[model samples]
Target: MESARDKRTGEIVDAEQLWIINPVDPMGYECRGCSAQATPCSYRPENKVRPYFSAKDGHNAGCDVEGEVALVKRARKQRVTIREGFPGSFPNRLVLRDTRPVSSPDGSPTAPSSDGGRRTGSNGSSERCRNRHWAAQTIRPICRTFINYPFDRDLPLVVPGVTADTYQHVFRSLKSDQVIQYPEPRLFYAPISWKASIADDDRLEIQLSYGEWKERKLTRPYRVRMDWTDWSAAKRNYVSREIETARSEYMTAKKRGDKEKGWLFFIGRQDESDSTLFHVDDHRLVCCVVNEVIYP
Candidate 1:
């Protein structure tokens, strides 16, 4: 899901989505949210059933940019190039994490960009960020995406496994590199040593979001806590409370039959460090956050 960023707050997840030209599967698509011709290949041709960009109500009718279409004949083949391309340009970019350093498995060096893809900053250090303390996350995912909940799609489940090899194994088995990109950042899951009370049985709830919650008009930052301790009644209660506030809104909409709006499953983590540094790998279970509204 695309997020809006608060520039003043040191770059919150600004939900701006860009239409990425799939190096492979250029012709294989369904629109990415609304029809923007600049990202004509983002969605399939069938999405433009009505033949207009969007109606006043905002239901997309077709691609927004036309005539100067630059979509490739195939997307997956050159998908990596698009990411590692020119360095200064691309159709669209969604920033997932700004200046965050994630440790490598051996904790030796900074980890490379999540997938095998590479990027080159002007200084050239971005080419292999595994050594650097920060990574610039730009995601070009499907217009209609389900990062976690509806795992039915071939979408990579970033939060469900362990081992450094897990990422490569999952990405390699997938049919499309375009699949490498998604509607949202791949679900990053990690194991947490919390006890059974909060996550008794396999049933658990977690909240996934990019920025800090705030009062109306961005009054103040809302505090988020993660329950990684052994399952205690108090822990369960706290988890339940977190669910009610963040996940419940989307759950209610989805379960109560609001199809237009979908939810993104995010592994919840207690950021003892800061709001942006979500230690998802050590997380217990999953949670949902109904992100911003999107056009189909």
Candidate 2:
């Protein structure tokens, strides 16, 4: 599972955030749907795969997680329009909290609430719950949804500091042909180039696949320069590791004949002087996502 409920803190945490914990509690996680015991996997730095949670034994009868996955898959196969609304639940807003309460060791184990895995409308009806939207703690889930539901890009979204309302308007793709000035900030995404990137103490610059090419060689590609000047060593490493892991996964899939591409997503502003460059500071606002084709 991509997310699980923390028994100690009564909070739903994304699996990617496990690295921030000094020592993860083995018995502190439970399924967000069935409240079954969950085990964290591939969370260590040595693990190349992305971190996720799995049931310790098996999920209980009528686990919503499986149903939710099925619903998403079914929705992906359909042609969705903005007037009809999204067929499944999705995160509509990005909520970036400055600080979170620390989990107490002596705290009582908290079970997942009735509405933990799903959201209900004001009427509290099952039909209304189908199109519910939740707030996301990180941009990773938002990026996943963006890639999964390409047909529903017109769905409503709320990203702080961004003026755009729909997913299609909020996410801007960097053009490879020419550099253009962006007056408004946006959530930018670009395909990662296989070329070598620049990493230094002050910042890390990553080359995008889209750029000016000369005889099949990338001449002037747009780049994202992450300023880790105020970030700790661990934080910097986390960001770098995520990008590497995504690239590795994409390559592995490609070798197996899967058409996949590693894409970088970040909420940043384009440089005024250099239109080919973007500036990102916070690690939380940036993530690497591998786009995969979902077969019905």
Candidate 3:
């Protein structure tokens, strides 16, 4: 059997630790002896150990591979305690997430009131509700697809610059696009600037993944995305129109006051000529996306 010293207990053991080093960030784990950390390298063995805890005590258990079962259980217990006060004095203390199962008592909640009158959470936690009446405006009924667009407007947009001099202007142009417009109450911003290789005869493509305030309206980890693309700018004027449209999106978002948003961008040239340009065409603007999509 393969054996190694246990890290936490510092005990020499026959059972090994199944450390689950992140596939993306190898540096997540380190050698306790050498104090050397692992980086992203294909050289490491395929079965890198990821840390996990489970039944079968000691090192005998397969641990985390079974999934984060323990964590999920804890979440359920916490939710229950919050929604149905933990057998105690303060009934009002119990609170449920906008998406909790059912209240402690299926019927109604009555908390001791200062004035001696009973207070019921029949209406629930109204203010903190995800769909709280608190909105810029009552959202107009919208298609589910349309409503699911990426929105990151509350944040700033950060686009990397090309030339120190022209960079600002170009950035300003793209900066304007990241803001969220009216129809959708959500706005998005991201700093997108990366280098990529393009082959000849290949069409240029840019993928923009954005996010919005969570669906339930909880500011937690809720977000959406929009895939904007334009194959070939067959009609030069149409390409120009698309650019104008992208620019227009920024203008519209800015006017609505979502100006501080940021977003990402990539430039790649086409290879229809049988030669690898690698760089985008100066005459033709990037056409990976067309038209600004708005969600109401």
Best by TM-score: 2
- Between candidates 2 and 3, the one scoring higher on lDDT is 2
What digit string (tens of lDDT, one per residue) describes model 2 on residues 1-296? 88776766545677887776668887878876666899988888887678899896988786666466776675577645456655555678887767654544665324322224334557875321222466677788788878777767778889999999988888887776766787888888888876666889999888888767788877778899999999988878878888888878777777888778888989887888887888898888888888763432
Candidate 2 — worst ten consecutive residues by lDDT sum? 108-117
Evaluation by TM-score, superior candidate among 1 and 3: 1
User: Which residue window of length 10 is worst by lDDT in model 1?
Assistant: 172-181
Model 3: per-residue Cα lDDT over 1-296, one tens digit each: 11122222222111112221223333232221221232223223343332222222222233221222343344333321233322111111111122212323432224321112222356753221111001110011011111122131111122222222111122222222222322211112222212221223333322233323345331322111111233343333333333343444544565777732223232332233422112333222132221233321
lDDT of 1: 0.28
lDDT of 1 by residue, 1-296 (tens): 13211111212121221111123222122222232211122133233211112122332443221211332212212231333332111122223442444544543225433322235779856432212111124321222222221222332223323222222222211111111222233333221111122344433433222222344322222122343454554435434443444344544555777743223333334344443333332222233234433211
TM-score of each: 0.25, 0.83, 0.18
TM-score of 3: 0.18
Sequence-dependent TM-score of model 2:
0.83
Which lDDT value does model 3 have at 216?
A: 38
Superposed on all Cα atoms, the candidates' RMSDs to the truth, in angstroms, are 17.8, 4.8, 23.4
Q: What's the lDDT for residue 156 in model 2?
A: 86
